[model samples]
Target: METQARLIVDVARLDEDGERYQGELSLALLDLGASEVFAPKGALAYDLFAQALGTELLVRGTLSLPLNCICVRCGGEFQKVVQDRDFVTSIEISEATDFLDLTDEVREAIILDLPSYPVCSDTCKGLCMTCGKNLNKEICACQKAGSDRRWATLEGL
Candidate 1:
């Protein structure tokens, strides 16, 4: 069955077992802002269950989003998927709280799950320090020259 997505829960309408919410959140709404190193390729997708637990609302789900990242080692652009499989949170609810928005929770989960230093591959060769060349793509002239300046005198002797 095609279930309609629910981003905002109707607190008053929630049954004893609660309701399931599944949808894609727009990247624009997140206001993640411009990032030099990385950016969201698309919207953040979520599948969650929201239920009432006494005075609190319990939310649990998974979040995943494709990101275009600049490889930290080679400075090359690459695409990666960031996922939060164990997303869980509890929000205190009240009589006046008729609606519970899940946007904030989703945003926080993604931000916390983002990788600090992203790489294109585990075996990335990085870049040539002297000529600023991507070692993974092509070798630099510096590599053909010598290993180090300190070894130049020893080789001549």
Candidate 2:
């Protein structure tokens, strides 16, 4: 089922302690383009608290989302949960600010927490450069070629 992207709160209902919010938002709200490298497998969950402090409104929370990613090194697929324990955002508010919406902030928190280049494991051997083989699975039959042929004379010295 589809989920809501907006998190609107009425400032009038808030007291000195502020108000707490907990809900799930649509993964599409993140605006991540279609790509096989990475994608969200489920909705993003958030537990947040909002308070009005003088002229500024503060929002702090935790966010969690499951992601399906392809490892950059070996091209293997893996699932990982991206979480941000201290998601915080502040907006300037005035007397005229009766309501606050934090739809974009929630989206940014999840995206920023994701790894730029995901890997299945830190010790992955990755693909062979010349033979086009997965090194982690088995040894390649091709001989190990030197990095540069021009440096052959330097090896004797």
Candidate 3:
């Protein structure tokens, strides 16, 4: 099942009391082709804040999820555990506010923070370049010739 979460806070308008709320969610990472996301779960907590420039809004919350990452070293998948990730953000929903966007900012932060390439295992032996065989699964018996020109020179001497 997909992970869903709800964040309740007095955003856009400044909350004098800085109200807070929390929720649980289950998220998944599907960009990795040959990998699966387990029971990924996390929580969200937020509050209100006021800046020195008089700009006021809600901020301070955490969103975390456990990930089963593929190891590049071993070609074996494993669980990569992580703790809560705080997203201190501000939202502006006022009639004359322009800083009231959170979805795009949050999405960008998550995507950009994702790993570029995930490996199944840490000690994963990659495929053989010459034969294109998976070295991790099995070893290749391709002939390895020692081409040493010094052997010809010794014969002449």
**Residue range 65-152, candidate 3, lDDT tens digits:** 4566655544455665443366666544454563343444444444444454666555777766667667788776541321234566
Query: lDDT of all the models against the reference?
Result: 0.85, 0.81, 0.46
Write one digit per residue (lDDT tens) for candidate 2, span 28-105: 666655366788898888899999999888989899988899988889899988899999998998888888878778
TM-scores of all models? 0.81, 0.79, 0.46
What lDDT score goes with residue 92 in model 3?
44
Candidate 1 residue spans exceeding 4 A from truth: 1-6, 146-157
Where is the poorest 10-residue window by lDDT in model 2? 141-150
Residue pairs of candidate 1 with colliding backbone atoms: none
Q: Which is the winner by TM-score between candidate 2 and candidate 3?
A: 2
**Candidate RMSDs in order:** 4.1, 3.9, 7.0
Ranking under TM-score, best-scoring first? 1, 2, 3
Higher-ranked by lDDT: 1 or 3: 1
lDDT of the structure predicted as candidate 1 = 0.85
